[model samples]
Target: MAAENQHQVPPPPGLIASLAGLAKNCLHLLLSRLELAAIELTEVRDTLLQLSIVFAIAMLAAWFAIAFGTATLIYLCWEAMGWKILALLAGLFAVLAVALVLWGRSLVRQGKLGLSSTMAELKSDRDMLL
Candidate 1:
């Protein structure tokens, strides 16, 4: 029975066959990872597009609302404050602009948008493979 079993067993693959199988497996793995990345990229693109559209609409609405409100406020106080309200609003806008610029600069300096996660994954793969 043992002799019969031994005879029935398959032979080991040759070196070339082993290498070809490894290459085929590596190709499959690469293709799968690429597909996953493509899917994620598509999702991110869709979300970003929607967010941009909504933000633009909201910003437009807010701009008109603020403009009307400010105009009304100035009209109401026209006799009392004269041009002081306009000057005050201008100063407020200047301060807000400075604050926003500084905040944006800080975000850039922190490298928050830099592809940190992908870079880390690439580094780990490199370390593992090499």
Candidate 2:
């Protein structure tokens, strides 16, 4: 029995080594994917910041232009229409502003600003894992 046990080969050494190596590789892959996700999030944040700044500047400029244009129009018609043009212009602008506000609200309700690509990538990753 002792002779037979001695003659029997030990399990292959590569088995344990291969399992360790696979675990290490999986850890590395997970770290890489996390890094990629972080990078993408940073890019999205920077883009949003830039867009916010641009939109704020645009809104300011538009407000100034509208104010000046309305003033100019009122001045031009002041002599001909007396003070009545003021009321008409005010009412017209109010109606238009309300319409624009409603349109903007509708767009917001529709969630047009969702992170579509990021969500898609996450979904794909989930599918791959499953």
* lDDT to native, each model: 0.79, 0.83
lDDT of 1 at 12: 96
What does candidate 1 score on TM?
A: 0.72
In model 2, the runs with Cα more than 4 Å from the true position are: 1-30, 99-113
Worst 10 residues of 2 by lDDT: 111-120
Candidate 2 lDDT over residue span 83-106, tens digit each: 899899889989989999999799
> Model 1 Cα displacement at 79 (Å)?
2.2
Clashing pairs in 2: none
Query: Residue 42 in candidate 2 has what lDDT?
Result: 81
Superposed Cα deviation of residue 107, candidate 2 (Å):
6.4
User: 24-111 in candidate 1: lDDT tens per residue?
Assistant: 9778866766665666667767867997899799889988987998899899998999999999888987998899799969967996
